[model samples]
Target: MLVALRKIIRHFKGDEDGVALVEVAMVTPFVLLLAAGVFEFSNMLNTRMLLDAGVKDAARYMARCSSDWDTCSGYAKNLAVNGAISGGSARVTGWTTGEVTVSKSLSTPAIDSGTGTELYLSSTANVDVVQVSTSYPYAGVGFWSYLGFGQISLSVFHQERVLGW
Candidate 1:
């Protein structure tokens, strides 16, 4: 039995016929995992970019509008979610107006908080800044959980200098 096992081992050592196949079989899972990682990373990057752009756009819109604070904030949230103040398709799947948060600073424009309803402050901590933020749960191709990375939430915000009209 020992001699037979040695013969099998020696045969395998000299047999180069399936060497490439064996190497590929050994490395395929790792290569596949690498590819999946790249794909998932790209998706996350794209989602993050969309979130940033949306928040920035919303902040810009909010900064210029001198309308009612609640109304303006609503429009800003709509714009952030739909890319249009009026209405449009959401930038990301499962994204809604609920995820969007539009807020204003209290000390910006050197105005008093008691001035009027037009400047109803939403965040005193972010004074001198107009903030648009959102938190979206990233819905990947489900490979993240398979890889033991349960879930990911893309939380993003953009602040703009207060320049209200």
Candidate 2:
């Protein structure tokens, strides 16, 4: 009986049938993690680009908008969120006018104070710029968040000279 048991142990020790299976099992989780990370990153970047386009369109609209029009800011907000002046489907999910921000600020040309160049914006000397911005939370496929990657928000903004004057 002892000699028979030793023969069985020797045969089992030399067996390599399950080595590949063990290796695959060990590597699969890491590979899957890498794949998920790639997917999430790509999705986030795509959505960010879309948001950038939307903001740019809105800013340009505001810059050339007519002063006679009522609710210009409102129109710009709608354009940024819905990609249309009147209204339309959002560029991404769960977007709203509240998430879009519009503002106007004065910009002056570069001045060399050392050369005695004036560094101020007089009433008629400064350029008026309109800015459109938004921050959208990423609603990913959840694979990334489930792995404790947390949430990512895509923020975009665009500025254009107010030329409606």
Candidate 3:
């Protein structure tokens, strides 16, 4: 039995099956990093797109001089943030209407482009997403979080101008 076991071990030692193990070891980290980056990047992009839509919608209401209370700039800001994150908490940092200079060289600017024919409305929002600290959970796994690679901050800038005269 001992001789048979020794032969089995020797066979595995020289076998090509171990090559797969080595390849996996070499590529696993890269694959994991790519996955994590994709997840993070997608989340950020989705948030930005949502914010841009919100800001444009808000600007639209402002351009119309809508006084429907539900369609005001404040409402637009709230809509922009809440729509992006369904159940998350988001705060509107600033919602201001300003007179943007329209360059004479340019023809009639598009309405939804945020540069209105006469005025422009801009909205800025910052969002904080609660990310779990990887300190205690993954510490035993030898992955360190001291590299400043854990947290994510989200910000958005949206602008629009009304098409109405």
Best by lDDT: 1
Off by over 4 Å in 1: 108-128
lDDT of candidate 1 at residue 136, scale 0 to 100: 89
Candidate 2 residue-wise lDDT at 123: 53
* Per-model CA lDDT versus the true structure: 0.82, 0.81, 0.42
> Can you write out model 1's per-residue Cα lDDT over 12-83, one digit (the tens) per residue?
996789889999999999999899889989989998998888999999999888888898899999898889
Rate residue 96 of model 1 by lDDT: 88
lDDT (tens digit, per residue) of candidate 3 on 1-165: 999999999889867867989999999999987776677566556654654555555455444543553335444444444443134344232222221111111233323345534232334222111111111111121222344555444444433334333
lDDT for model 3 comes to 0.42
For each of the candidates, the C-alpha root-mean-square deviation to the true structure, in angstroms, is 6.6, 4.1, 12.7
Clashing pairs in 1: none
Please, what is the TM-score per model? 0.82, 0.78, 0.47
For model 2, residues 6-47, the per-residue Cα lDDT tens digits are 999998998999999999999999999899888878888888
- Quote the positional error of residue 9 for candidate 2 in Å: 5.4
Name model 2 segments beyond 4 Å from true.
Answer: 1-9, 68-70, 107-124
User: Which segments of model 3 are wrong by more than 4 Å?
Assistant: 1-15, 68-71, 83-146, 150-153, 163-165
Q: Please name the candidate that would achieve the greatest TM-score relative to the true structure.
A: 1
